[model samples]
Target: MHIKKYFGRMLLLSFLTLPFIQGCAFFDNYARIWVASGQYGTDVKDLIAHWQDYNISYAGLSIENPSALLFDTKIDGRSITYEKWVPVTDENVLMTIVKWL
Candidate 1:
């Protein structure tokens, strides 16, 4: 009887912690957009302003084809594929991206 009770308690604790553990993994797979940009860093500020003008709720922007100055992204399960251009004005685009986060 004591063994049975202990097992029951252990099972309950595991179930209670399951959601928390899953949540960590869930957020890990989510991708956050930092910013969007156009050629020569043009239209960035305007784009942001446009979103605001339209009352869009967005964390950041993602460019689809940096070469073409387009933005594309995909969200599936616990993975995100976001593409964006690196502003030419910024010397270190990678660092800038990290800073946006």
Candidate 2:
């Protein structure tokens, strides 16, 4: 029983530390999104234009929302919807993408 507990703890610790050891790209990508989303007043279109700078790909934009920016991203080798919100014009163009949140 004690051995099982120890193994479980080790497993949890490993998972927690794995990102730090391997340079987690998810957090880095999120940070860029945060910044581009108006953390520093950067435009979202600029973010899309420079996705390659962060090694992230722009999968596409959302049709329903029109302001949602989608990315071809995954974390821990699993698929996830990495969506970022921004403003859009009536013609489907990005407005400002800066919201005070």
Candidate achieving the largest TM-score = 1
Runs with alpha carbons beyond 4 Å of true place in candidate 2? 27-101
TM-score of 2: 0.25
Off by over 4 Å in 1: 26-101
Per-candidate alpha-carbon RMSD to the true structure: 14.0, 12.2
Model 1, global lDDT: 0.44
**Model 1: which residue pairs collide?**
63-71, 63-83, 63-84, 64-70, 64-71, 64-72
Residues 1-101, model 2: lDDT tens digits: 99999999999999999988877676655545333344546555665565443323222354433333443323346544454533232322322222211
* Residues 10-50, model 1: lDDT tens digits: 99999999999887567864776444556525345554433
Output the worst ten-in-a-row residue range by lDDT, candidate 2.
Answer: 92-101
The positional error of residue 51 in candidate 1, measured at the CA in angstroms, is: 26
| Each prediction's TM-score versus the true structure | 0.30, 0.25
Model 2 whole-model lDDT (C-alpha atoms):
0.47
